[model samples]
Every structure is written in structure tokens, then in C-alpha cells.
Target: MTPSIMSLFMNSAFLAMEAQQVVWLRMMRVAAGGASADRELSRMATEKMQAAIQLGTAATLAAVGGNSSERIAANAIRGYRSRVRANRRRLTK
Candidate 1:
């Protein structure tokens, strides 16, 4: 065969191989989507629960009256703030 004809054939063969590879990659992505989706849902649920707990803690702090118990509530709020900072660092990393 002429060099030009052989080069064209080789290029066509490479294109077909690439197309097949792309199809397989898409199929694999679809197959793995189920587990990844489940993991994402679980992550979202955990974050929501954490937010709820933080809100509840804030509500407890607000519920304290203007008495001696205020000191204890203030301490709890400080602890909650520390926990929030730690969680932020953990999540950001």
C-alpha cells in the first residue's frame, strides 16, 4: 500500500479505538452512579442533622433566664462555639 493510504487507515483505526474507549467509560460511569448517589444522599443527611443539633444548642442557650443559670448557659455556648470551629476546620480540610 502507498504510505498516504496506510497513514489514513491507521488514523481511522485509532479513531474507532478511541470511540470504543469513550463508550466504555460512559457505561462505567453510569454503572457506578448508583453508589456515588447513595453516598451523596447520606452525606447531605448527616450535615442536616448536625445543623439541627447546632440550632437546638443555640435554642437552649436562648432559653436561659436572667438568673445564676445564665453562667452555665454561657459556658455551654462557649463550648458549642469551640465545637463549631473544630467541625469547620475538619470539614474544610
Candidate 2:
């Protein structure tokens, strides 16, 4: 594979790991009584739904516009990565 392809894979892998960390941290906060469990769970679920919608919309637009496969994948990944990064920042606080 080309270096750019490898880099994309690596970046996606790293993002996945960070997202998992965010999930665990959020859960820990609720378990430790730092946040109300019901509210936190509801918020998390809502965020996931929003992210899914954003990702689907981006990917669909790219695909319909006749962009390359890579572009479509990038659009989806970009939206997801942005959300994951934001969650990571917020949860780390």
C-alpha cells in the first residue's frame, strides 16, 4: 500500500482508540457519581445519533456528487473524527 493509504488507516485506528477512551471516561464519570447517570446516558445516546446523521449525510453527498471513493470515505471519517475529538476534549476536562 502507498504511504498515504497507510497513514489514513493508522489515523483511523488511532481515532477509534481515542473514541473508546472517551466512552470509558464518560461511563466512569457517571459510575463515580460525577454526573447523573440517566442524563449522561441520554446525552451520550443523542450525540451518537447526531453523529450518525452527520456522517451519513456527508457520505451520501460525496457519493452522489461523483467524488472518488476516497473522498466519500474521508467525508464520513472527518465528521466522525471531529465528534470524537470534541468528546475527548470535553471528557478529559
RMSD of each: 25.3, 2.7
lDDT of each residue in 29-54, candidate 1, tens digit only? 44677975466457546865886687
Give residue 67's lDDT in candidate 1 (0 to 100): 31
Q: Give the range where candidate 2 is weakest over 10 consecutive residues by summed lDDT.
A: 1-10
lDDT of 2 at 34: 46
RMSD of 2: 2.7
Give TM per candidate.
Answer: 0.32, 0.84
lDDT of 1: 0.52
- Give the clashing pairs for model 1: none
Q: How would you encode candidate 2's per-residue C-alpha lDDT over 27-82 as one tens digit per residue?
A: 88789774476777888999999888878877888788888776666656667888
Residue 11 in model 1: lDDT: 51
